[model samples]
Target: MKAIIAKSNIGGVITTPPSKSYTIRALLAAALASGQSRIFNPLVADDTEAAAEVLTQLGAGIKRQTDCWEVTGGNLAPPSSPHQKLNCRQSAATLRFLAPICAALQGTSCITFAPGLARRPMTPLFDIFQQLGVRSELTENSLNIHGTGGQFKSNEVSLPGNISSQFISGILMATPLASEGLTIHLTTPAESKNYLRMTIDCLQRFGINVEYDDNLEEFRVEHQAYQPTDYIVEGDWSSASYFLGMGALSGPVTVTGLNADSFQADRFMLNCLRRMGAEVIINGDSVTVNSSPLRKTDTGLNEAIDLLPSVACLAGVSAGESVITGLDRARLKESDRVTAVADNLKQMGIKVIEESDRLTITGGTPRGAVIDSFDDHRIAMAFAMLAAICGDTVIEGAECVNKTYPDFWEDFQKVGGKVSINE
Candidate 1:
């Protein structure tokens, strides 16, 4: 579906969506724990749903209640009857995180996905799985995984930091369950360290112990079992960043249901926006953002790359020029985010310069133009936020926001954003 945005002003209170990061982690832990676990405020986005479906296929009993989900766990088991296919669609987390778990399961399983996922590089993950005695073959759009069920030897494995960190997190999540504990060594500086921290924190919450020495660039997991517990997923800070951008660019918007101390890296948007002259108030689990004259500054936000799309939107509306650096890893995300931002902003008549890793935006009044989302959720939402400043913008492939925020357009509409879908 396509969407058009008319010029509008935004100022209202909106509750953020549940955190996909927390929801997926809780689902994985619940599926691994021995007893039933309750997850509250679970996300119902495509990615989270993919994780739920994958966990269900892995022998976890899932029951969705009115507002919560209960998952009963046991040994990772493939479908009772043999099945040749497990489709993950376009969820990277489900495909990457579930692969090793499926490999460690009792039977053989084959994982397949949509075309976009099929074309994604999986050689790095395949090499790691090979070290664990798991054999996988990549066909047209499927990965045929044959597990030896042999013991996973604990060894030091070095990973390149340029690619998706989910691969490392996937191996880390499965390591504690391995017969021998596993040790992971980082060959280069890990991009998205905050996401890795979220994984480690979730593992500890499930009663698995992981010891890490960042200075030594090593992580060790002990052979242990997970203890199921009630997990509450916080509201998504990444999703909240869009609204925060709107508030910064437009004015006096309040976003609730987000924790001020979220482990999610996108929470750093508070600081970035503050630096750009947005009035930000953080009170425990709530944040209120008010508009102020934004001035461009030189800031490095490598630790908060997930918020780059929205941050780019913020920078686009700010006064003067802003230089956002330390984003060499942004190209490998769901979309090549750097180019996506540059291309979309350029169409809006914003002066955007894209480098190999950094993006420089010369902020000025944006003129309305047609924008392409590149089928990326963040790109869609980021451009939507621009509607407050840029009048009469049309977003092609606007439905891509359903990947993370199914109700994004509706929520934006609630906050005085005039949007109409072109069916």
Candidate 2:
């Protein structure tokens, strides 16, 4: 899939898509509830679909509706026939969240991962699972676990802060079913604390109380039932950041349907945009950005790491040099995003310096160059936004957006972006 994006300015209003992070959290949280639950404005993307399918196979009743999804879930019933295989479809969240839940169920289960996802690290969370008496065997691209089909062995689980927050969330969601409670101690000061905040939000929304200190060094949760409730998914700040980046260089772009108080970590992009001199307007649930004197950035990405590609793209067109830090976690994503962003920027004749944990981009007028997305959705979207100012831009693997936003191209076009597909 190739996308040819020509230089143009986008204007008018486009509503941001619902958050994939929140939708998946809602699905997983709902699956543990004892009764019917309604989730409104859920994101129906590849990743969220993977979560839904896995939950369905776990014997949860999931029904799609016009405006929401009705989920009836309680105890998971092992697929009537034994030895059922589930494909996680390259979603890290799906794999991480499901692994621990399957262990809590104490049932025979096997999960297969897409080829590209096989190499993602898992031992950190698995170590804790093993501590809870969940036995697992790892082979290439798949995980086979024998779950006790009930509460885990109550114990203190310590995890490093650098890994994906999904690790913390996955365990937090599953430990409540254990015979006793569990305490999560952060061995290092927790990084990406906002993602954990989202996890805590989900847990509390489902009627599970979480105890944590101000520093977020420790968390304690006991065996508790997840109560079903009506929930609404919020607009994704990560996805919306792309358009806001475009708005900084282009004109009159406004994204609606976002929550100002969202726990979604990417919401911090608004502050960064302000720092870079983009005119941002927050009216009700929508945010509008207009042309401004965009400048270079110096910010930490510990929490908003997913915004790296977009923010880096914004930096590519700014007037001076920009430095972004805290990218060590980026290497573990679907693709080595840090390297991918740096390489693609270099391809476009932009001056960039790539390091293991930081990126320094000297913003100037960039020329369009053929770029590969490295099968990363954010990379494709990031460069797409950058294309508006470049001489010409062609993005391969453009369809990767389906992982989070299936209609990304259409939405881009809707906002007056001059984009065409070359298939």
Best by TM-score: 2
What do the candidate models score in CA lDDT, each in turn?
0.83, 0.88
Q: Point out the worst 10-residue segment of candidate 1 by lDDT.
A: 147-156
TM-score of 2: 0.98
Model 2 alpha-carbon drift over 4 Å, by segment: none
lDDT of 2 by residue, 1-423 (tens): 899999886887888999998899889889999999999999999999999998999888899999999999898855656667777898999999888878788577888889888777888867887677778888898888788865566568888877888888888888787767788888888888888899899889999999999988788888889999999999999999989888888878999999999888999999999989999999999999998878888989988899899889888888799999999989889899999999999998889999999999999878889989999999999998878777488999999999999999998988888988988
State the lDDT at 97 in candidate 2.
84
Models 1 onward score TM values of 0.96, 0.98
What tens digits encode model 1's per-residue C-alpha lDDT throughout 1-423? 888899989999889999988888889888999999999899999988888887887778899998899999967776665563677878888888888777666667878787887656788788787677777788888887766452665355667765677887888887866776778888887777888888988888888888998653579987788899888888999999999888888867889999886779888888898889999988767788888888886777677887888888878878889998988767767788899999988887889999998999998778888888889899999888887677788999998988889999999988899999998
Regions of candidate 1 where Cα sits further than 4 Å from its true position: 80-84
